[model samples]
Target: MKICLVGSSGGHLTHLHLLEPFWGNKERFWVTFDKEDAKNILANERKYNCYFPTNRNVKNLIKNTYLAFKILKSEKPDIIISSGAAVAVPFFFVGKLLKIKTVYIEVFDRIDKPTLTGKLVYAVTDLFIVQWEEMRKVYPKAINLGGIF
Candidate 1:
């Protein structure tokens, strides 16, 4: 199966990195934020196009939407796995619209509440996972997968 790992830089990327072992035996793709620090990390690798302004910047949303479609159209991945933040929102939606399975790993830092993007993408996601088991009570659909990375 072709799994598309999407997330922001920092911790999101780290989480995805941990799950990299799972994809070593399967065809996989990655999509992390294109920040100055992350630019070279995912480069020269099999990762898809990266985005900028990793935060909830206004200007980047529209651009991200277009890029999302481009990635979805080109990659046509079978599934998407993401660690929450705003950037993953567009990518997750792309997978949803394309009828692709998606695994969402809630941010490790969000212990008591849901992140904005996490809440937004929950309904459409195929498998919602969390590091903390307590989150399962709030997000009844989520599975407790412990930590990714």
Candidate 2:
């Protein structure tokens, strides 16, 4: 099945990469920022660069939303998975509208509290995965698969 892996740069992307064993062999591409770490790690992989100002930037959010629609239409991924930091929001929203299955993995660092993106995507995601057991309290329905790393 074709999969679209979406996440921001830095730790979020790092956490997603930890699942390479599971998704590496699948027909997949990535949606992430064009940063040094992302560039180096995804050097040989297919990817779509997402916009910046991820937090509260309405302008980039709008741009990313448009980008999401285009990507989803062309890629038509069977599933969309993300370890997020805002950049994954548009993709997940658009993917949901397109009836694409979505999986959101909570960031590995947040154990006690929930991340904003996690909260926002929780309702829409088909599966919400948390890396820490304590996080289960925050995301009651979340499946605690432990740390991806």
Task: Estimate, for each residue in 64-148, the C-alpha lDDT of model 2 and write its tens digit.
Answer: 9999999999999999999898988999999999999999999888997999999999999999999899999999999999877
Candidate 1 per-residue lDDT, tens place, 1-149, comes to: 88787877877787777775787688777777656545666665576555677566767877887888998889888888888678788887877887888888888887768989889899999999988988987799998888655
Question: What count of clashes does model 2 give?
Answer: 0
Worst 10 residues of 1 by lDDT: 36-45
RMSD of each candidate? 1.8, 0.8
Error of 1 at 72 (Å): 1.0
**How high is each candidate's TM-score?**
0.89, 0.97
Question: Where in model 1 is the C-alpha error above 4 Å?
Answer: 36-40
Q: What TM-score quantifies how close candidate 1 is to the native fold?
A: 0.89
- Could you tell me the lDDT of residue 43 within candidate 1? 66
Q: Which residue pairs overlap in candidate 1's backbone?
A: none
